[model samples]
Target: MIRVSASGVNRPDVLQRKGAYPAPAGASDLPGLEVSGVVEGGDAAAMADAGLHIGQRVVALVSGGGYAQYCAAPAGQCLPAPEGWSDAEAASLPETVFTVWSNVFERGRLQAGETLLIQGGSSGIGVTAIQLAKAAGATVIVTAGSDAKCAACLALGADHAINYRSQDFAAEVLRLTDNRGVDVVLDMVAGDYVEKEVGVLAEDGRLVIIAVQGGVQSAINAGLVLRKRLTITGSTLRARSVAFKSALAKACQAAVWPWIAQGKVKPVLYRTFAAGDAAQAHALMESNAHIGKIVLTWGDV
Candidate 1:
């Protein structure tokens, strides 16, 4: 058995908990995606069955069932915790890193020196995207609802942090880029932002939508897309096949893991609650007041 130290709370967890996102066939009903822990006492076979070992510290992605004393996960999804990192820090990595890598880099094809705009700038995915894009030599812009959130994004290496509530993000983006527009738009707010995102996309720009927090349906401008040759696509990580996720996890391990080990990338944690307080943690995420990730710690870890 493995002892869980910390579990990251995500929107899918909240959705699963509320019955909005139903568990797939043969999946557990528990609500957690990523966790950090140490193996206690289990046979090598059992440990291998769970993709772990006795006394080894690890971080893993779980389909569900993460908010418990002992959680089981496939060994392929687990990675050794970086040396000297806290369980909370290690626990924070998998979900956001996987999501961002799959959506922004793999799908969006964000390239060096490209201009990228990320919505929800203070979110876990937003912070990680900013750092990664900047580190990869891209000019990163972010949009948040509050000035403090904008400042936090700027602090996290965003080139421009726009207050979505105070200004028109598309206009701000246009102004910031001298009307040439951005090369990629990493959007989570899919409602009315669709039109605006298309408006600010440069020639051959890629808009990758990862969430629909505002609303899903929207009117689009086909002419604009055709004129600019923009590509609009979106994806979710949880529903993907294990092989796909494993590939993403492996790619992330190779590209971003070294940076994390060297402190070039750091996990941004907003608050950590106990596992029993998962309901409250979900409530906090819904409030959208957090600047980074909200995690649930198991025991003192």
Candidate 2:
């Protein structure tokens, strides 16, 4: 458990609120998915093994209940907050960071010198993916809904940014890569985007879809899959087992945490609303007007 300081507002939270997604059975029904706070109490043996002590500051990913003044998260899901970051910034890291690390590196197997295309380049997950990919010595191309959002992605170290509204992203990706296509695509918008994502992949390329914001069902060319040896995969983090998430925590602690310490990565917190103003926060998220993360803060936290 933690004395919650701030809570991250993710698209999943919005989906849960509208009944489009539900908390997995035996989990908290509250909306927040991530939090940053001080350790208050927990199972002693578990906390010790997790390298946590009472009063230590940490950020955690949770299934729900992060919006409250206190939240209980599995010990293995907690990570020490990076030094010198504010509550809001730290609050925003766990969900997006965990998702990107698991999907882009673990599932997609992106490696140095590969080219990656990221959908929704200005989202919480998108920004995290861009920096992590670049830091890992991979090239990054991203697609956003507008020019400003595209600029935001570029400024975050994306090698190229496509304004999806002004450009056909698949064509642009091909053109940017000189028709060779990318090695991997970290996708949030699945549905129809899946076909084009498959189209713009090099042989042995991987396409990891983390969300179905566009829709779940998609039609893709089996020939491309066969010829390119493409791998298409997708996952949601909320219902995964504690053992899997614990391993992710260890991976991030070894890899991404050091990057954060070196300033190679930084959390992009677009805004924070008072806990009481959560409705407005959710509205901003659903409007898709923010370029980075949105967080909710508790009283005086």
Candidate 3:
């Protein structure tokens, strides 16, 4: 268990707030995916195997109950918070880090000498993808709603950012790649964008869809899948087996945590609200005005 000091508010939380997504069985009905706090207690043997001790500062990925003052977490899901980082900053790590590592690298098979196109480049997931992909030596192209958001992606080390409001992302991506197309696409907009993503992928490319923000139904050309040997896949982090998540947690700890320690990848937090103002935080997330992660703090510095 953790004495929760801060909670990361994410897109799923917003979706749950609107009655769109439901919490999984045995999870708290409260809306939260990640938290940062002190490890007050847990199964001692599990904690020992995970190298965790009582009073250790940690950021944990949980199925639910992160919004509470205290929450039970699988010991393996808790990672030590980086030294000198605040609760708000540490709270931002788990969900995005785990998602990007599992989807973009594990499933999408993103390589060093490849290009990745990300839809919704200004989102929490988008920012994390840009940094992680760049750190792993991949060229990133992102599509944002505005030029300012595009600039934000560029500043975050994205090789190119397309303003989807003005330019056709598919055409721009094809043009930017000199008609070769990108090696992967990280798409949150799955409906109409799926067809276009199909159009702009290089042979043997991958498409990892984490969310369907643009509606679940998608129409894509089947011929492209056969001709290019494209791999279109997706996964939801919640409802996965503890063994799977524990493995992912170990992966992030081994690969990404070192990046965090060296400053290659930092928490990209846009804002924080008091725990009581969680509704306001959710509102800002829905508005899409923030550039990175949002958090709710319960007085932790």
Candidate 4:
């Protein structure tokens, strides 16, 4: 067992709570993907047998059941918490960091000096992607719904922040890139943006879609994709197998954890609510006014 200090609230959690994403066989019905806590008992002996400390502070990715005082997780999914970091900050890292690292770097094959256009720039995944891409020497462009949200993305090292509500993102992206277009487009808006995303892709550009918040189905321009040699792919972290998530966790620890520890990257926490107020926390996430992460804190910490 582990004492959950903080649990990050994400969109899937809200979806699960609302009966959108059903819990898999034998998984917890509670809606949480990541958590921070101290090891207490149960698997503690097993972890120790594998050379892990019993009372060590750690952060982990869970498929479900994170919004409680105690969460049972496999030891393989855990990583040591950055020294001196708050539980809220540690709690915020696993989901966003792992998602960004996997989708933006490993799968998208985004390289240094390339230009990346990120949708939903103020979101947990967006904020984390902006920081990581910028740190790795990429030019980052982001789209958000409000001026304040755009400014927040810019403050987090985005080279350009477009207010999607005020301007056409595709036109703005084209203007910013001088028609050459971006090397990668990390999109969460999958409705009408699909054709536009394809239109804005550079030669051999990769478009990785991680969510469909706008709408699920959209018509695509096959001609634009064929002409641009674009590649479009999408993934969800929650439905992935344990081995995949464990590999992702290891990759995140190797690539981004050091930067976090050195203060080059940090968790952007929007708000914190008590564990009992999980419903309120999910409601806050649904509001879409938060800049980064919303967390539910548990225990005395």
Candidate 5:
């Protein structure tokens, strides 16, 4: 159990609220996936693995139930909050960081000296990706809906930012890389965007898709994929097993936590609302006007 201080709002939460996405079997039907709070009780083995003490302030990724003052989470999915972070900031870390680590580093296999192209770079996931990829020694490129959003991504250490509304991202990526193309593409938009992303990869590139914000059906040219030796794959975080998330938690601690500690990467919190106004939080998220993360706060912090 955790005495919840704050909860991170995510796109999936909005979908779940509208009855578009259902919780996995046996998981909570509540609309949150991550929280920050004090530990109360959980499996001893998991607590040991996560190095969590009963009173420790920590952030955790959960399947649901983060809207309340007290919630339960798997111990293996928890991590110590970074020093000097507010409850709101700490609450913002788990979902975005976990997603970035699993998809960008673990799945995409992005390495130092490689280039990464991120779709929707002003988002919670996008901000995390830009910082993490840059901290890992990769050149970062991103696309956002507006010029201001593009500028925000560039300010966050993206090497280049394309306003997707006024610019052709594929062409810009090619131009930026001198036609060599990026080595990895972290994509949230699927459907037609998938084909465009495939067109912007270098030989032996990887494309890791984490969301289908556009549409679900996508068409790709098999010949291009074959010629480029590209890999296309994607995963959703909520349905994975406890052991799987536990492994990911360990990996994030090893690879990503240092960056946070060193101040090389940090959470970008847009706004926080009282827990009673969760609907407003979701509305802001759906509006797509805010940058970084939206959080809901409980008073105990």
Candidate 6:
């Protein structure tokens, strides 16, 4: 158990609230998948392996039930806060870090010197991906809805940003990559985007979809997928086994956590609301006007 200090606001929480996305069987019914605070108690072996002890400041990726003063998380899913990070900053890391590590790095197999086209560059996942990819020596290209968002993505180490509302992202990606296209695409919008995304891939490029914000159904040219030998896949961070999350946690502690400590990557905090104002925080997230992340503080801490 963790005495919750802060929790991150995520789209899934909103979806769950609206009864669109239900919690997996045996998971908490409450919304929120991540939190940060002092460790209260848990498995000793798991805690020790995670470099955690009783009363230690740590961040955890919970299965659910993070929007309160206390949350129980898998012991293996916890890690000490990055040096000098605030509770809010630490709180913001788990969901995005875990998602990007699982989908972008693990599933997509994004490597050094590759180019990544992130669909929602100013989003929580997008910001985390941009920083991590850049730190790993990959070129980052992002598409946002407005010029301001484009600028924000650029400032966060993206090589190029396309205002999708005004410019065609596939065309811009081609132009930016000298017509070769990106090596990977982190897509949040599926449906029709699957076809357009397929058009902007280099040979053997990978497309990892982590959300279906646009729509669920899609019609794609299998010929494009076959001819290019592209790989299109996706996964949800939650609903996975504890062992899987534990492995991912270890991987992040090894690969991504160092980047955080070295200042190569940092949390991008947009606004933090008091826990009572969770509705307002969700409103901001749904508005798509805020860049980076929105967090909710649990109490006086």
Score every model by TM-score: 0.94, 0.99, 0.98, 0.96, 0.98, 0.98
lDDT of 2 by residue, 1-301 (tens): 8999999999999999999999999899989999999999999999999999999999999988999999999999999999999988999999999999999999999999999999999999999999999999999999999999999999999999999998999999999999999999998999999999999999999999888989989999999999999999878899999899999999999999999999999989899999989999999999999999999999663
TM value for model 6: 0.98
Each model's C-alpha lDDT?
0.86, 0.94, 0.93, 0.88, 0.92, 0.92
Candidate 5 C-alpha lDDT tens digits along 1-301: 8999999999999999999999999888888999999998888886887788899999999988888788888888888988988999999998999999999988999999999999999999999999999999999999999999998999999999999999888999999999999999999999899998889899999999999889999999888899999999889999999999988988998988899999998879999999999999999999999999999999833
- What's the true lDDT of residue 152 in model 5? 91
Q: Can you tell me which runs of candidate 6 are displaced by over 4 Å?
A: none
Superior candidate under TM-score, 1 versus 5 = 5
Full ranking by TM-score:
2, 3, 6, 5, 4, 1
**Model 6: which residue pairs collide?**
none
Give the residue spans of candidate 1 off by over 4 A: 40-52
Q: How close is candidate 2 to the true structure, as a TM-score?
A: 0.99
- Which model is ahead, 1 or 3, in terms of lDDT? 3
Instruction: Extract clashing residue pairs from model 3.
Output: none
Q: After superposition, how far is residue 191 of candidate 1 from its true place, in Å?
A: 1.0
* Residue range 165-256, candidate 3, lDDT tens digits: 99999999999999999999999889899999999999999999999878889888999999999999999999998889999999999989
Model 1 global lDDT (CA atoms, 0 to 1): 0.86
- For candidate 1, lDDT tens digit of each residue in 136-159? 789999999999999999998898
Best by lDDT: 2
- CA shift of 22, model 4, Å: 1.1
lDDT digits (tens) for residues 1-301 of candidate 4: 6688999888888888788899877778878989999977666565864345768899988988888888987777788988878999889988898899889998899999999999999999999999999888899999999999999999889999999999999999999999999999999989889888988889999999999988988888898888888899878888788788877877888889878877879889999988888888888888898999999898643
Q: Which pairs of residues collide in candidate 2?
A: none
